[model samples]
Target chain A: MEMLMNPSQMTKKYFTPGVMLVSLIALNGLIFLALRLIFGVGAITNLDNQHPWGIWIGIDVAAGVALAAGGFTTAALGHIMHREEYEVVIRPALLTALLGYTFVALSVAIDLGRWYSIWHPLIFWNGNSVLFEVGICVMIYVSVLYIEFLPIVTKKFIGNVRFKGMLAKLNSPVDKLLRMLDRGLDKTMFIFIIAGVVLSCLHQSSLGTLMVIAGPKMHPLWQTPILPLLFLISAICVGFPMVIMESLIASRSFKLKPEMHVLSKLGSYIGPMLGIYLAFKVIDILIREAFVYLMVLSTESVMFSIEIIFGIILPMRLFFSKVVRESPLGIFIASMLVILGVVLNRLNNFIVAYNPPYATTSYFPSIGEISVTLGFVCIEVLMYRLIVKYFPIISIPEKAGVFKTKYSIQGSK
Target chain B: MATQGRRDFLKSLSAIGISTIGVAGITPSITKASPENILSKDRMGVLVDTTVCIGCRKCEWACKNAHDMPSGSIDDYENESVFDNKRRPDYSALTVVNKYQNDKTGSPINVKVQCMHCDQPACVSACIVGAFSKKENGSVVWDESKCIGCRYCMVACPFQIPSFDYHKALEPEIRKCDFCFDRTAEGKLPACIEICPVEAITYGRREDLVQVAQEKIKNYPERYNNHILGETEVGGTSWMYMAGVDFKNLDFPTLGDKSAPGVSESIQHGIFSYFVPPVALYALLGGVMWISKNRDKKEEN
Candidate 1:
């Protein structure tokens, strides 16, 4: 609700010795991205007619969108569900969602053969297409997330309106604009928040619809008519866990006290949602008589088993334990499992179980494809670091003053 | 020619009727018929008699020549070395003839592979920009002008027919058999259909082809298999095949009778049907907002 640290108290250091590794990886990714753009997708990727979509769609778009579910999920929990305690994590979750969606859009752009025509979806209306719904919803939802994020940006610069040199003359107008924007955003914030949540559900489910069209091509274990529902539920189930995971990771990175009290309570919600997802998943498979396929020790069955066992069921079982719920390490592990589970589920749906009937050989992402994906993620992390440092995205704890000055030197969380 | 062009245009106008008939919105599996039949009652189709195919790759050559691609020489295609490995139709080639050894017949059964051009093509439904259309003449064609080259059509096509010009950096096109749409509109047979020496492939109305296929199968039951490939597969395809052996042996996908778009469209349209679910979802969010607002107000008081 308030700025965690004063602008003056914020760390001035932009780079550290440890940042070299991230820079190198990000550089490598950017290079591949350039190669892909110049030489075309065929030069950088193994994708063929048989395997048209690779990791760019599977991990970067589908999984990326699902993992970013924390934004809308936390918004609903903190504001709509009336959970005041989750307010601390809400800013970070929202920030994560904003950056995550941006990356998803960028990844989609690079993946498209005609990247310039990315704007075609905006002008062209193909309502019957599942992807059309996803494209429209994501475009609108990303804009909503940015609008919801505006207050934080305004909070940082609203008061400190002084600009140096030539810009000094226009500072007052800018400041006035910021104040007016802040006030306007305050009254209308609820609408955008509500829209973000609604739009999220639509597009999150529509990602699943993208795969449903590959009905016969997709393996039975992953292909179901209720794929959209499964995708929506899995995304919802992963939301709180993603928030918890992000909070813990950030705390550890910044050497701040883990908000175990707020997070442990968040932990309580995970099991029930996971249980509901599992129930529907099991029921859907059973109804379709697809469970028989799972019994086979084939690649598809093994991946499905790992996804359900290690990803969903394990986390669900772990979260129910009192020790797991109370401890930060326990909760973190459980959250990671849930996150990985959702990631695997998406990968399985879009890639692993997708066996095109006519394909002579299986598809694997080329080095360039993998690099571009990694680069997008690294860029997301770097951007997150930059934004959180500059903007008051993380709420300052009431007792944070004791450890504040020392942690500021350790740099952005 | 102008009247023929107008008739063709009018036929296409009718064929462009997008089918909205799908199963009720709730039951997950809402099946929608492909917009194939909307254009015309007399959609033209091709019927292939696989048993009679000579495994000569002349169809491939003719297809290239008709499309203005370099066919080299007709003699070059006669080299059987190309069929040494099972080759798929690719960027340069629109159609391919594959020779599969039929164990029962003790001879090779040649199958010509091209776009099946479904009555309800999966590509038509999958194209986000509506680049692909199932014409009244039973040709599933894609408009390059409208194509964004997302390659979803490649993924969605059941026959795996649509090939991308991946090598082209600036101008990539989805290359597939368009059922010789331009030639067909000009009242000319497709080059491949005109060039087949043994009459292995027959060009006619789809309904008439089905009847012809049935008559051939009934007359020479020993020579033909009762199963007609693409007759009912994926809600039927414009390109029908009558093979002497199992279609699977010839690289035909074992698809169910249900059309590819049926299951997907059903789920998508059903969920967003009449915009009811999304409106209801928005209402629920609004309700949540109201309750939350009221609780915060009470706390403040």
Candidate 2:
């Protein structure tokens, strides 16, 4: 990145071959989604009475919420903790969170048998339910993300409003609304930032509480009373790595120089964060004497082993090393590993550990299920790319010919 | 409600639509339709004596017929071929009878499977919309109007009894033996209990049923297992069993005495206890942000 910088929308071509491929995958997924909506969830997915929640819940909703922790984590460091060096990553993180939650909401609606009644939770809330907690928090946090992203929208169109013919007269009022929104948000942004972090903590842990009710239905290895605490810690640990992973991927995709200084500084905290989570996880297993279950070589044990070895310990060791933290590629790999670890942990918890009695066959996501999940991911990437092309989300490129942030001139950190 | 015709279904739908809009006045903490699940000493229960059952499967036919479900004929139930493979209570059949080959007698020990109607039902605690309610009669009933069909109830049931209608594109139901809430409300015995030819199923007040079960076990020591299934399983269920052999061998999911939703709900209540934790965290974060900004401003000056 250039020594002097400000966030500017990219001028590069948007429709590359990679994006075209992604669109094709998105199209495939939408086709299956149509089938699901018309013919019911059973028609498109392998979900049965034996296993009600497939990878759509496991990957799209649970893992989606975990991976999108970047928004709040970065917000805490940059705004709450007043770490100005991390400010550049905040906009992009907020966008990722906004878009990530939209996918989660879409997945939940798709996963539910009655998509029309999805809004029922808002009025028909059951405080006793862990899922109710997850649903309400995710709903509010998505709105918070949208509110958090409003500044970028306002910034882009504040004075740049241009429309043809009669619509041109309304552009000034629209710009006035944006300016008013921008000013109001500036005063109230702190509340949303704090609320975002608090909401994240509540729902992230409540997600783990979701399976605690399953109790004996889940395997002994994953079933613990401290499941919520473990979930909270892992979510906190995964937050920075997710931000680093997203930042690196966005930079590489846009053909811009990565922000090594900020990312490496972010990378330095990963070791200790992951170390704390690992310690708690180990202590939980010891307290429960769950190692006995692991002694037997089963799908549950192997998946647990892979999640710990490849996800936590390996990345922790890497992040602890100076060589890995300083290089863009090395930090990127370590962050990706951590991200994958959290994703795998969520899948293992939701899919593998949930063992209902009288199940003659185990659950495996069908091709259509996989296609829809993959399609959601593809669409997310396409949105991220398009948003960065127009919005001032990525502030890493050289500031030579790019437009200046005029309204935020005096507000610069 | 499960087998209601199109007109009845539409009427129910309209009722639900109005109630949903009516919910606007009600606080989310206490929805209007959310029943107060008060336990009673006189709550009804059933005790199955497996040793007495002849495996006639008349109970299965009666259950479906009472629920307005299609069962070809009472003759079809006596085919005796369903015992070839173990079955669960699914959408089509709300109750099923399974025969376990027992060496104690030449005849197989037949066990009936359906919702336990737990004293502390996990489905009641886990339903996202509070759709399930445990009545004073000990029947755990679900409202079709309220259920979103997320199947979280199916996941939470320790006995794995609640089954969903996956095939229906619209208004799919979570089917389970509702302990014959309708029949019991009319002061009539459950259809299965009424139809039992051999008096295999004994229905009465739950406490009376427990005493009856204990008397049966004590009177014929060799004919029954000392333990009564569901007597203490998951904090006790409305339906219980007395078998000659161990229940684990009878294909019942072995469960502890603790309720299924106990840990999860405690954790939930602990975290949100008067919302103090979230509020304090908010204040703490605001304080840190204020101090950090002030320190930066001082340094700039």
Candidate 3:
């Protein structure tokens, strides 16, 4: 395995003929976004007064934010927990989070009717509103994430190029700016890291608070006084799994051996975190007596059962097994299930469980809505590929044996 | 005595530290008083006597006309075919009248359906941008300029009264019964109150209306149901209803006396009370950072 110091040294192929499908999906999404802007939300969406928010809030913003939990969780484990062994996966996770949040902000703009008034939350403070908290935290957190990523940018750009023409005169100043930024970040990076984690916690839980205000509108199965706690816990549980899944998938895509040793240990943390989440969930149900509704075999009941059993409990059990953790495929499948569980939980809270009594019919996302969501996802993937190809986001090994399954098994144990 | 004094001093220190943390947590919530807009005692309201409504649909005609919406000829609103389906107040129609049979008398009980304009309105509390407000005149009004059209108000309203102009391409407003804020401001009754041929609706101070409703129910126990529709449900709406038939049969939701925003507001404010929980969380995180840094030094050595 070979490691390239600069992104320019990596392959710069734009198309492989196989990526046409992705490109086409992204194009369709871009067209629908244009339609939404020109004709208004009514022209392109199946959204009515009853269903004010659709897949844009549920899938694109809510689930997208939860999926990005890998960044903060891995940062805590590696930097805060001083787990040097987990450092291999932290940069990729951080990059994923930065891109993830950028798209969430973009998705919120698309979802708003008056997209231009997106900055209202910043200036006109509604401190009582959970959404106000979410908006402010996200705005600040995005800035913090970029600031955290600056050292990487400076490291890549400094001393690499001496520009010519008009650029030649500015080259020394640019180099000086990078050096200053790099130096400043080295001393103060921990403060931003701490702030990032704090901000993430505030917003992730506040997302649940948004749903909590729906109160009677949300079905009892999903609605609870501790909804904010549930949301925060589920996000924390999924964070490590997300990091593991991304690392494994990236290794496979880049034709490098998978980081099974670090990932399996990461998998071990999921079981305990998942245990804490499940305990709260069961207690919440019992305390509320919502278990009665779960017995009716209705859509909410069935969907809730699938979310808990297949997405959570099944994967949690898988993570506990030593053999499952040791095997690359086993850990991947387990992490995927946890990710699916968190995604399902967010979607269910935002859409399925929200039933307006006066609504003439149930809401289903229009093709345009689905396309826009898919387009954002495609953008995340393409951006990740582009950044990883160009930057030193993914750490590489000096020898071939480091990523072997047997090597991982022996090392992790 | 020396040992006892030392123990007492240490106990006092622990108690002081713990109390300081507790004070820090609660001060934020206390200083920033809960944003509960108090409804005025003398606010105006309407008393809707369903037993006397007569199913005329004249209020519907008057409402549309007064709001500058298309009424399509006042005579057209009297068509009986509209009664075949129960209709809600929409963008074009600010109010509607539905007919249901009084179970005991086998007579038609006419019910007027529109925004209740609750004293503690859920829409006002749920709106993120403070677009909805319960006015001094007991009108729950929406400010179009402030509304980002998130439509959270629609979801929050227990009555589901707020309707969006979904068909409009640009500058669509959330259409609802404004309780005739414009007319009432000019010392005129709401269009529905003025247009009722039977004089079934009584418009007055909310406190006076409650007394009037109570006296009527007490006087004609056989003619009216034992309960008032909006008197207590969802923290008492301005529009009170007295009907021969049970409100549930007349399509009124069976909501408790609790205000719609009460439960959600309590839980949200409770968790975030004082901002102490978040501060404690950051402290714990800082502890982790310190521990990890120490661990790193040990490993390096």
Question: Which of candidates 1 and 2 is the stronger one according to lDDT?
Answer: 2
- For residues A1-413, write the lDDT of model 1, one tens digit per residue: 22233222225355766556777789999999888888888998999989999999999999999999999998898767756556677878988999999999999888888888888877666656778778888999999988888877776787799989999999999999998887666655665676788889988998998988887789999888888889999999999999999888777765567778888988999999999999999999999999999878899999999999999899999998879999999999999999999999999999998998878889988999888888888888778778777776665455454322110111111
Which residues of candidate 1, in runs, are more than 4 Å off? A1-12, A400-413, B1-37
Stretch of 10 with least lDDT, candidate 1 chain B: B15-24
Which residue pairs collide, candidate 1?
B15-B39
lDDT per residue for candidate 3 within A1-413, as digits (tens), equals 22121112235464656456777888899999999888888788999867878989998889988999988888787666756577677778899999999999999988777777777665554445667678878999999889878877887888975898878988889899988777656655665676688888888988887887666778999988788889999999999988888888877777667878778888899998999999999999999999999879888999899999988899999999999998989999999999999999999999999987667789999998999999988877888888877777776644432431100101111
Instruction: Score each candidate by Cα lDDT.
Output: 0.82, 0.84, 0.79
Off by over 4 Å in 3: A1-14, A161-163, A399-413, B1-37
For residues A2-104, write the lDDT of model 2, one tens digit per residue.
2334677877899989889999999999999888888888898888878989999999999999988888888888778877677777778888889999999
Name the fnat for model 3: 0.34
* Fnat computed for model 2: 0.68
Q: Candidate 2, A230: how far from true, in Å?
A: 1.1
User: How big is the positional error of residue B26 in model 2, measured in Å on the Cα after superposition?
Assistant: 11
Candidate DockQ values, in order, are: 0.27, 0.33, 0.26
Writing each residue's lDDT as its tens digit, candidate 2 over B44-107 gives 8999999998889898899988999998878888788889998999999999999899987777
TM-score of 1: 0.91
Could you tell me the TM-score of chain B in model 1?
0.87
